[model samples]
Target: MIDVAELRIGTSGWRYPPWRGDFYPRGLVQRRELEYLSSRMNSAEINGSFYSLQRPERYRAWVEQTPDDFVFAVKGGRFITHLKQLRDVETPLANFFASGVLALGRKLGPILWQLPPRLAFDAERVEAFFKLLPRTSHAAAELAKRHDDKLKAEPHTDPSPRRKLRHAVEVRHPSFAEPESLDLFRKHGIALVVADTAGKFPYIDEMTSEEFAYVRLHGDEELYVSGYSDKALEKWARKIKGWGRDTYVYFDNDVKVEAPKNAIALAELLA
Candidate 1:
């Protein structure tokens, strides 16, 4: 069995400006934000990687700054999920794999692939994408080797292959609520994101993987602005404990700068 200690609770990102006054100290410098934030949470979702590729030095610096046990759940780029729509994305996938993510090595947790609201469930397309995913860092390195010329220069091409690579898929379409979707996820060893999107997206609470689980708490009442109430945190704690699986929960309700506070509250409840 996989180590259950991999379970973690954290917020999506730490670079939000609003969090400086509320979660971060008033006089803290911007450069030291990650270090301070890591001390408070065992894990954090790297949302910036979703928008663009990250450099090796950045990953190395993050590793040096955070505690030895800290892990980052890197978000997959939208170029594959949003723009390319997961089709004909071999090169894009290669670019992502080559984008210094492996530098996180053991500090890396799950890679989150969030599909847009417009993309509905298609078993063929989904299966194709899943097959392309690398099951291990070694595999990712092999995939990265095929990266186009754009990333050839100064690419962090080394493979760590520390442990098995895990992935979680977050879908917004209502069509994904079906049993077939769950079956597909289970077949590919991918976790279905248990998301709370203020009733805006389809909320599916099934455990597709016994090895691990992934959850994104967008908000309790409002999508990105509202905080999870104490009662809500307590309920989530109970459910999470009941799962008895290595779980990763990231609070995405950061518009009001309540994500870190709510995430800490939930972690405390579990404690």
Candidate 2:
């Protein structure tokens, strides 16, 4: 069984002003920022790869800067998962892992495959993609769509290459909050990726399965794009403490300000 207590949480990624100088110097500053942020939080999701391909040397440098227990949850390359929407991108995926990003060992968390809102559930595509993944201990899937009848009736299958890989599903549509959808996730043993968006949308309020709990707090819509708030961080911390399993919380809110500040506060709450 998965131990939820071992879970860690933080923001989806970190960022800095572009006026900071060249990418190298900016990266150096970012490293210092991450070090200070990680000092508080147990883990963070690296969203940078979504913008561009990650170099192995850069991944190695990231490993060198953080604490031993710091886990980096990386978002898969956007071209393969978002733009191309292919089930499998063998060469690119291989290059990514072999590039030293996944070399972090226990420091590596889950590989987030965030499908674009336009990409609906394609069983064949999803099946093919899962087959190509390495049997790592940590892996997850996120779908940013509304749970529809078609997606519901379709057979729920696990095509992941490894038995130990954990699957986490996220639904942005209201249909997913229904009892049937929740039951489906629990039946398949897929953990729900609870997202903190705006308004009265149905966020995952309870653990649907025994698997680890994965959450991405995108912050209030107004604050999300901007990223700063102590009140929100405190509220999220309270929510984390209520979970029974290891929880992964990421602040996908305004990265410019809140990512680092909330990361520090949330870490203190967890600690």
Candidate 3:
């Protein structure tokens, strides 16, 4: 039998200066920002890891700062997605997993791999990358053992073997909107990210995974700037309610400090 789908709503990232005195209360220290955000939202997407590998200590500190039930969706490193372009990334993937990502433990959620706009859909290349992904924590740990000397000094190689992992791909190029791309993702149980980039990226709403659905709302009218209106939130609420699979919605419109407010607004509608 299928389990009841869960809805996790929050922002793409939490550390925003503009949020000070706006979404965040005045005098709230920068370090305590995550602690405050967790009090209201159930999940958040960690985008820093997308830029570079994060140490295990940082991931552990994040877990301690948040509530027990909080979950974090980590963005895969750009070194793997953008630089390598999903080619010959076995060791890069291992290094990423070893670089303390597993420290999040049970609070760890899906791994998001956002493809660059310049990278078009390549079926063979995409399939090969998917094959390299570890299906469970145990497999991830084993893969982590293969990390290069770069992470040998301080790596989080071991993790709980009980939990399974999920991955989702966010595509930008229009080439990914075809049926072939959707079928490829379905064959591998990878969620095709429904990215709302305000006409900046190709938006594909198809659910490729039976396990879950991932959505990123960058903005409604302007990419990373505009806030979602009540009307837009209502429309999204309806769409999410209709998705039978578990859903994760993260607001990425942080430029104008609208992400948190919009996330709360969308969560309220879903509630």
Number of backbone collisions per candidate = 0, 15, 0
lDDT of each: 0.90, 0.60, 0.92
Tens digit per residue, CA lDDT, model 3, 35-76: 999999999999999998888999999999999999999999
- Candidate 2's clash total is 15
TM-score of each: 0.97, 0.70, 0.97
Error of 2 at 226 (Å): 5.7
* Candidate 3, poorest ten consecutive residues by summed lDDT: 1-10
Candidate 1's C-alpha runs over 4 A off are: 1-3
TM-score, cand. 2: 0.70
TM-score for model 1?
A: 0.97
User: Where in model 3 is the C-alpha error above 4 Å?
Assistant: 1-3
The deviation in Å at residue 30 for candidate 2 is: 4.9
| Candidate 1 C-alpha lDDT tens digits along 1-271 | 2236667999998899998877999999999999998999899999988998877788888899899999999999999999998999999999998878898988989999999999999999999999999988888988988888666346777887457899999999998989998899999889999999999998999999878999999999999999988899888887888788899999999999989999888887777
